[model samples]
Target: MPLHPFHGRALARAIACAIASASLGAHAEDDPQRATTLREVRVSAASHDTSVDPDLPSVVETVSAARLDRLNVVNVEDALKYLPSFGIRKRFIGDENATFSVRGTSNQQSARGLVYLDGLLLSNLLGNNWANPPRWSMAFPENLARVDVIYGAYSALYPGNAIGATVLMTTRMPDRLEVTGEVQAFTQHVHDYGVDRDYGGSRQSATIGDRSGRFAFLIGVSHLRSNGQPLVYATQALSSATGGPRPVTGAIADTGANGLPRQVVGINAEGQEATDQDEAHARLTYDITPDVTAGLTVGYWSQDMSHRTETFLRDANGQPVYAGPVTIDGRRYTLPANYFAPSTRQSRNYLYGASLGTHRDTGWNVEGNVSYFDMDRNRDRVASSVSYNGAGLLTAGDGSRWRTLDLRASHTPDSIAPDTHTVSFGYHYDGYRLANASYNLDAWRRGGAGMLTAANGGSTQTQALYLQDAWQLVDGWRLTVGARYEQWRAFDGSRATATAGVRYAERKETHTSPKASLAWTVSDTVLLRLSAARAYRFPTVNELFQGSFNGIALVNNDPRLKPENDLSRELSAEWYRPNGVARFTVYRSDTRDTLFSQTDTTVFPNVTNVQNVGLVRTRGAEASYDARDVIWPGFDLTANAAYTQATTVRNRRNPASEGKQFYRIPRWRANLVATWRATGRMALTLAGRYSGRQYNTLDHSDIHPDTFGGASDFLTFDARVTWKASDHVDLGAGVDNLTDRRYYVYYPYPSRTYLVEAKFHL
Candidate 1:
């Protein structure tokens, strides 16, 4: 199927319409309090320390704690929901598997980005897909001071994962005694696929902090409880079965994403889940000197989850049908017995971290950090039969853990001269061990480990050394150059079943990456920058050694797989004015040996798993406008539009993917947010998000998206209102997905949702 012509240029049309409105709606000269810094950013809105100017030539986005309070702050990820060209897989309030996506990447690619909290790595590098998302529940929204995002892999200080993006979250240290508390509640009504109901949740958080002389301590806790909407529906392709069918009603005749006929019977698999999550964290910091500080942080998170399934099909006598043959449109169909079975999971995670760093304007400075993350206890109970308390399986990950270490030093000259420069050097080490084992159980909910059923486990390690230098070439020109050398190894790869177990030999590889950035200040109000880099991303543990099995026979395991090589480049032009700033950017990326999961349609029976593709090319452009007091004294606006096109150039094993659009990446994305302050303490906001055409299959076979199992265009609007009751209290209300548009991204997204919140401070 061919794309609709007008929809292909969605970014262009959206930008044009927005510009037309802004020209007539804004008065740039109205605001007197808005500040702008062009050549050098010496003044900021926040009081936090963020002098990491290493990502000079790339586009960076920053938001302060004050700005976050105006939006719905139920979850920390909500702070980034309005950013441009960003995709987050936060299905519900307490979803534990939320992943991050940016630019040309998909939300399922969890290992292609970096997330840090107070210099501690939060990204789980054990795997490369949905199962390996960042550990974000440990950071409560009320405890953050600021958040910064750096685009592209243009800095030598970070690993190859920086090619997607780098996020830095800074926690606050109080100057005096402070206590804060917040409570929030939300609800959403979903009506889709013969299922209609209301799902809702609630959250509560509190933080206490104080500073006494050279010592400071902070403690925070938060909890969430939610009932999510149905995420899966049972369906079977229209087939010719040679058997008499039982008459059943409520079976929906539908077409699949690929235009194949199917019957939608009921919700199955990961149906509706009731989630309860709790997290606690504490931080202690001491100032050895006025410019030197040491800190220790401990965080713990836990989740107890269970599920409930519902059926729509019924027999002739009005009895609900759980399984067996049924007739839909005179065609015989059989619903699997285990289709509506539910599973339960319990998870306990802990993170301990320490950091020692110096804060100085010039001369030598040193910093050291180390963190350890462990899955203290984990169990996933899966049922094989729908019968009550029947036999099942238990998967345990009790010994899975990861460790990280970083040591860095930097020197800055006192003055800007021909020989003056800022030099930074660092050494980094990271290790991850995955230990997962499954055993047969006598009962689903109340059962112990019985016989060995299946197992998959592996270990990965990376060590790197890097150096970078930034210097002023002339009056208005600055240049930066750097390189990183890394050695990656994978070992202790093993898989097992009831029969036997097997281990893979150790594998090791070394690679060097180069990076550069150049910036030229054309004038006080304009600047131009160019950045280029080459990154090598090593395969993760699951991608290297993990495989599926069919009755003890090995399948889908690849021992010989190469790393991914990516060459990325970007150029940007920035304009500054009294009210705000505007920027235009273009970027391109060429990659080889790309690690991804795709189904080979050329084969007789489709096989879906992780594989390496030969070549992929992606290019895009973005335009952004951010200004405060655009029309009135307290009016602020921020908007951005982007266009991206990613295509597969070559693939030897999966030829059907060549010359087709890459999976899950939309061709266009746009966002808009505006705020109006009615009084000194009252504010109202309106926000919009858009995503254009996307495909679920690499061959572009999933046409007519908007059905289940397809990646479709997404567009939604959000609004929020906040009022300061007093100097120590605040209240807020908001709505998301105002139109309740029906859409899909392989799963039905949230429908019309309502929110209410209250906060107190002393």
Candidate 2:
């Protein structure tokens, strides 16, 4: 069946608003909690909420469903954009996939962040980096209840991988039997110089579930489609030295024969693409006994995508040449072979998992989970190349398939004293396999008589043991200490690694990290916080085992690179009042063994290598304020600002390169959000975000070319409107990127767009 398309963010916002309206109404009859605004605690930072207090050693942020709705955040990447410390880059290579980096620690070529769904690891085991474009589409956006971002490394808690940050997502639970759905449409325009082009798409989702009497179930489906705009580029011959066309044969023939005549030809930019997604989830709870409870959850997801494009060939005179009929590998071919799509690619994925947990008053809590995932991609052409055999056309084809399994268990103690103490521990295991099996048409058409297919597969197994202790040392004073040990092994391949960390925190006005902090409650309305700790991040699969491909150039992974480590410290102060809240924090990180892509001149087209380059230092500060109670009932306003500076301290061949600013690391970023409740059942909100100019590449060179360098600055605005129609029903509408400004957060991002949505609940 053909896939469907829709604007993801618009759909999510509409659904969130409807759910929020229903939840609020259901609780209106009960007494509401006091409005003593406090930063929400995040489970991803640690295994439990004992670390929720701001006096802890880590920096954490939480995005609730209500906030997501207000911002029209549809995917995980979009949700993280709200955090000033996080950066995202979406490219045309992977439509549904985007890249995420936290602080300045991310590996631009391959993502450095770790992803978890309800505490289950989503990192690709066959490779080190998290999957490109993230597997976010695996779950319907409306299913997300909250997202937890834990900044800095928590090797002791998460082990081996905790580097720049860890993202954890928790889906919502049905409160009662319910049915909900949403539909949205959007249009976009991209104008280069005076030429103008238009593109647009639509999306829809329907959900049915029952949440009552300890039993809940939810099933949903979502789809999106778009007619993409064409791409333009300056084409050149393969070589200027060789004047005549070289023999077009062998594996490298598609790149144009060594001396092939080349000329600039306008490429067609017309094509259509679509995606279809479906999901099913269920949760069961039983009060095994008065003090004990058991819960089970199961979920499944699937997605399918398809796209098509056109191809062409130019002659020496820079004009179209009727190459009649060319034949290769016993197949006949034509210039505009209906099969060639210049910018065509397609992929599909299926995921499912289940988990069980038990809670008891005996001061003991235990949970176990297991999951499976499979993904596949098919391409009509290997890349932008074309081939011909004696018979006709032999389009190059490629396919990738992945399968994974994961298991985890955790246990926490039940009770203690006023100085409440708890020790928690857990274990995790993962397995993965990837296969590249497709016909190499180019290889055969060049003279090779046999079919060619490149096939390689590998697996990885990792184990971690960690323990943490939380102690309320004294009134207004808290202490946390923890450590973890991790080991990883690759089968059919060769490599093993291990690592560890410790942290401490104190509540005081003047605090020092990596040392001590002293917080004094000078008054009922004032308090101080101080903290310090050491953090680190290990290398991922892509950095160590990935092979090179042709795009920017050839590249290879170096398995010899070591893990990156850091020693960090931070200080902060906060003030709380009946009507408002304010906070400020300053932090610095001393990082060593940073990884980067290095060139190898020894090989033709020099292959790129991943290496531990040098030392880096980063310092930053952030301030925020929010007012609600003092501004009149039903009204709230919040503003936040941050500044960061990062420099390379040392490197291999160029010690002078030290002090160079890190690439893609913005110096200033900020945001503001305001909301007004016109009535008890109606509300409106506005939000604005800004990012300072940042260099894209690491070399910091404008003349010398490198993949990572460029500069960009952007501003975006969004608005939302909501209405409570009745006790059980609500409606909402929203607009994102309201200005429809054509810009790029990174190169090749989609241009300005508009979206509208409608949601219903029963």
Candidate 3:
């Protein structure tokens, strides 16, 4: 908690800005259009701006409300699935608990991807742990106005754990009283398999505000539920060591010979058992002025799992056995019992902030803002089981609590002709605290083993200051330069340490990010742009100083680890025509000192160290085509495809995986979405996703085997039909996973399902 350094950095940035302004007068003025229009506009693009311009160098994609409704995307993950650069792997279908990796950075368990709701940070400030990773459950898709995806390193602007990409979710703000609702149900059948699964959910939302357009407020709530099935293939595999049939459960216990407890084996289908999920969210927004707005949100999620296999005890034979007695964390339980395992997660996030921006009459414009973010998450996992002695037992009751406070502010200068420029400086203060406690049943069962309870908690605070400037040197070319300096300190009462990253980006573009190409407006219908940039990522608290607690022994955190930095450059061109649009981009990211988990053979079960393993180089290409008002009136078609190759360029000492492929990062991914509006009140849509094979683990060991980890591909289809019953009422029906292709994605995704719903507005 030192204030001197932060103040000094701020002062230095102010002085630098003054110096730049003074020097601007002497330099040969570049194209005045470059300085006045492109430079200032590009700076706004670097941070947050809706308008798509070519001068910005970062890749950004926006999902529209109309698109959301057509796809019936209920969660944040679904909303952005069409983007070629982003991928999501969920443990269950119809569940918001998912692992998201964009541009291959989020593939690692320790990877950090920042999430924001209306500019409020949702990434946990606690030590980096998947338990507290930014979750999709915080906001429902039904309440979103739009989702903006900013790809690559953005820490220089947002300042936190933003390394791979930033997902900005903006809630719907209404200008008039409006209400909408939908209910859906569907069944999925695995191809070549007789098993068919069914699931469904419903949502209702309302927005009440005035049409005056100056002062307005919007409040909405959404609820969803589903009975999800397991995605892993349940078929058994023969073990090479014992020649015994191995069940494909991932990390769960396995049966041994004669049912006697043996070594745990591999199982594919052993993921979250049949489970029911419930989620609810509420958002309130108020527009204080035409240039400023504020909002608050609250969300709750609960999961109830039935028949979840806690442990696999073996019988006398090598065959798998379900009925038996077992002990977990020193608690004994009987089989064939409910085994009820329930977990509840809830979050309350508040944002009371405003944006003040203006275009001066003198042609000098300025934009600045200050905001406060308070976010908290509570998670509890409880297990209740029956004992062989016919006694009721609650073996494990564990819970964790996390809270974060964030404050940020930024400023942009006025645009000057031919040399127009914007210098932005900001400071961010982030405070995070976490507490976890786990209980032991053996202590209470044995009548006083001291009532075993292990607890740990810590706090961290960080202050960051950054300065960025966009200078227009010519009409078609611009330069963007910025650097961020951060100082982070963790307090365990007395012990503390600090870390920082200084990053910069320089590029020229005709449009913002992907829209940046080489094509120029030779005519009214032809335009082109091309550009590239360098981005970096910093390590999170969990990856640096996290302590281990989970039963899995291979995963461990290294306190001495350094930050992972990368140089990412992309080049692309696009053609915009009256009938359709086609764009393609080729990108490469050379990462040095990439932080990754390295297994420690020094231990029996093997521990791991989160280290700057070596260098990783990734190259990829993406193409997309969109045709609006296609052959049929009111019909639209969009198709996107991406191919990526990621490999370890250095790992001289670790031969075990020196050149192995990264985990969970597919080399190829593609999607297609089409929609047709037959009438003002009716629409039909179809969508599909495909991902190439990927490795599950770095070592490729059967114990952590690459079996459930290999390449998997599946095709799913969905369609929705809506009808306006009256001015105040509307009805709709939809089917998800229309083909019901039984497939595994990261885990088991839900099979095909159908739903029907109706809504009434006043």
RMSD of each: 2.7, 10.7, 12.9
Clashes (candidate 3): 41
Total clashing pairs for each candidate: 0, 44, 41
Q: Which residue ranges in model 1 land beyond 4 Å of their true spot?
A: 1-11, 16-51, 417-419, 600-607
Error of 1 at 404 (Å): 0.6
> For candidate 2, what is the TM-score?
0.74
Q: Which 10-residue span in candidate 3 carries the lowest summed lDDT?
A: 506-515
TM-score ranking, best first: 1, 2, 3
Question: Which is the winner by TM-score between candidate 1 and candidate 2?
Answer: 1
1-762: candidate 1 lDDT, tens digit per residue = 212223536645776577546645566573444455543331343422533453344788777687798777677877777676788888777778888878877787788888888888889888888888899897888888877788878889899988788888888889899999989999998888987779999999899999999999899998899998888888889877644678778978788999898888888788887999999999999999988989999999999998777788888899988877777667777777777877899999999999998877678889999999998988988787676678888999888989999999988787656646788999999999988889988998888899988889999899999998887788778788899999999999999888878899999999999998887889987888888999988888888777878876777777677888999999988877677777888999998998987665567676766788899898998888777777666888888888888889998778988988787888888888888988999999998788888888888889868788877787788899999999999999999887776778888888888999999999
- Cα deviation at 217, candidate 1, in Å, is 2.2
Worst ten in a row by lDDT for model 2 = 503-512
| Estimated TM-score for each candidate | 0.96, 0.74, 0.73
User: 1 or 2: which has the higher lDDT?
Assistant: 1
| Each model's lDDT | 0.82, 0.50, 0.50
Rate residue 78 of model 3 by lDDT.
Answer: 76
lDDT string, candidate 2, 1-762, tens digits:
111222323333433343333223232221122233222121222222221223234556666676666555444466776574666664431245455765666436343566666544554434433244456655566777777776665324554345567777776657677788777666667563223667766677778777656555666766655444443322233332432331221111122112243332233322334445454545454545543334454445444444433323444344433333433222333344323433333454545565555544345656665666665433333323333333221222122323323322333334333466554556655555444333334332333222433323344445555555555455555455665555554444322111211111211111111223334444555555555555444444445555533443323656556766667666666665454446667878777887666554335665557767578888887665554532456665556667778787877534445677776676666666777878988878887666655654455543211111124455667777777777665566666556654443323345555556667777
| lDDT at residue 57 of model 3 (Cα atoms) | 48
Ranking by lDDT: 1, 2, 3
